[model samples]
Target: MAIGYQSLFNDNDSVDKANTHKIYDVIIVGSGVSGSFMAKELVDAGLDVLLLEAGEFFSRTNFPKKEIDANSKLYWSGGIEFNKSADLAFLRPKVVGGGSIVNQALLDRFDDMALDSFKEQSGVSFFTKESMQPWYEKAESEIHQEVIPKEHRNKNAEIFAKGFEENNYLYDSLTRAQKNCAYEEGNDCIECLSGCRRDSKQSTLITTLKSAINNGLHMKSLFEVKNIVHKTDEVRVDGIHLKREYESFRAKKLVLASGAMGNSKLLLNSGFKKSLPALGQNFYSHPQFMVLGLFKEQINSGNGPFQALKSADPNFRRKGFKLENVFAPPVGISMLLPGHGEEHQQLMKKISHMACIEVAIRDTNPGSIKTNRHGKMIIDKKLNEEDKKRKNAGIEAINNIFSSQGAQRIIEGNLPIGLHLMGGLGIGERARFSVVTPDFHLHGYKNIFAADSSIFPNAPGINPSLTIMALTKMAASKVFR
Candidate 1:
């Protein structure tokens, strides 16, 4: 009977209206970092929690060691997809761990200046540092957060660090959530994209999910929630319509954490609110580009951790948020190379000594995420004008860093890709401007909640995982009560 909620996705006839109608406390959509954190919080608060994930549960070992396989299989849009233009490729994860499994594990505290801007425009007072600082601190503690020690860094990082010194820019080793450390200096590169094998990268799969399961939380993976069913008013959440192969399951109280684009399309298809509009807007891609460095010496680039060093200019928000950091998995750099044949082979020769740094631009351009009639998600976005201006600036920043680090024959290229796509079902003031409220509750739908990047009113222009954890922790505290 404990598996009843999970069995909903396994059998179509199990939870039919005539067979049985059992209502539970919470049905949280998504098993990503935020949802996992919420599941733990709610279960610890003494509530029966059902976590619905659109993807399969993947263990760390389940990931492939090769970067290409990791990208094609674990990534959201199959490692590459176009965002408004074919020249750009957007990378999103399809696994339950979300981007945590593949991301460079760059943890950053959002600038108060950016949060203040959101508060000023959206009238959402929760965007202040003083209000959210304790929550961030608490989340960080729960995640066992710490900056990567210098000893764990590779030669490429030291080189990049020198660039910061030369330019008078502040550089700090980025924070990562790994357990016991077992990283080597330069060949640990193959592990970054495939998910950490050393129990080192403490992605959400090992962190909060472990806590939730220990607390008796039920996780339903490979089950996609199709529609929300409402049984009159008074709002007990009633139940959900979900799919597992050919069958469907139902639940009471639905939580939509299906990323920004996924949630917006689902809400519209469910007919939650048709004329209300603005269901999927205010979206940001955090468009990313890479600059590769091939040094004169055989400085191994593939070893150690991913992105041990990072530098960001807080003032970049006006131009655009520019984060510069070295990347791992020597082969991962090949995808970003712009030329073919001889030119590509030349870069490949020194690949062993190669390192890369990426810049994820936070832009304000509005985009739309909708589902086609064929049940496929579709996203259309215009490159943010300001993002275009920052592209070169971002490349220049990374290039300068590499130069300072003694990199030679540096190559630069932008991929048609982005990560941490957000704000499809954005939370705002009135029904006219936004679909969801600041609390992540939809404007007209009660008990329906969103706990993912979809609720982001503005791109924080920083790596969003920890920020998502902090916000969802706050959301659980406010909504689940």
Candidate 2:
């Protein structure tokens, strides 16, 4: 009950949304990568900013040490949400930092192909690689990014590299938003994937949010925003405290960076369905599943950098998928392996001798997110025939790599889990399905904007945190300019 508040410095009530009297110049919904960056930029530019988060605020000092506790406290539905068909699970963060807090910290720029696709879909020239390059650099400069050196790779990563090299498959070290760590000596980077007890991961919670708070940004966590009434002059945000009591705030400008699902749900709940018919349409989540190889020797896959190597092959990109060396903790990985009872326990016992690879599909078949009358979010995502083919191809490639390394057996994850959630209030030319214009403005509303992955026209087959930040920078510049 007392979990979702930020007691920064001596002002314990500073994060209380009701404590403020004057209308803020800008109210940022969600404190993830996009909102955090936007909040920092606006506050530094002498604008009064208020950030409202539905989840609790947590620091590295008080973050959950165990993965189970982390899942329950920091993630939505304990990080085990599923689709309508119950075949896929989606991992969404419910904490202040959002996805940045729970993600693997892979920081990659959008390639030319992805940029060109965005331009073609949204008809926005600024979406091109040439124009967005400086914004990407600006986003990267705000966070610490380093390539995982060969010396820092664990045996699991080494095995992946060995197979890729022997098989002549294109692969390279991944660039992650991480500080120097002792992962090579087996420091266990699994904690970073959960809640990051080490503080080595460069999430916006510790970087942009900290800087914004220092520059007079008021952030209230545990406040679920349910409605946003677009008025002639100001936007009224109606939210309820964790206690289920009603509270409201007014802002001259409202920025919706509450993620793809969150933004869609809010707009639908706010009675804007008629004006914004595309509120929950064009949703995408890069569907991902893992393939594990059973090796004779103990690889201790859980003891080091979880994702150190990634396939750089152009063929896979052409096929609309990508592969990366990835692993998870006991609870996370166990869900991927099939079977139960003695059979499942036996595989769990051999987890230390397993090497893992993840296949993330850039799904062409877009999905939809709808909310029932009772306000429950319904996610509908299914793999089309093309997606199935690409997934099969990725699995075969993983099998080839593991077999080249002399794997005794290969295990494929049957159920897909989506870590990257994008689109909902997509930007495009003004029409029936365009929630936002090319300027990132809500179609019918003047002072409302979207800066998160919710506005992505399509999914880019890479980690989207950096791109989200870059998009935030571009959106914020439009505001200040």
Q: Which candidate is the best by lDDT?
A: 2
Model 1: lDDT of residue 116: 77
Q: What's the C-alpha lDDT at position 21 in model 1?
A: 42
Q: What is the C-alpha lDDT profile of model 1 across 274-339, one tens digit per residue? A: 755888778777877777787878767566665677765554556675655656454556676767
Range of the 10 consecutive residues with the lowest summed lDDT in candidate 2: 1-10
lDDT of each: 0.68, 0.84
TM-score of each: 0.88, 0.96
lDDT of 2 by residue, 36-59 (tens): 999888988898888999888887
| Full-model lDDT, candidate 2 | 0.84
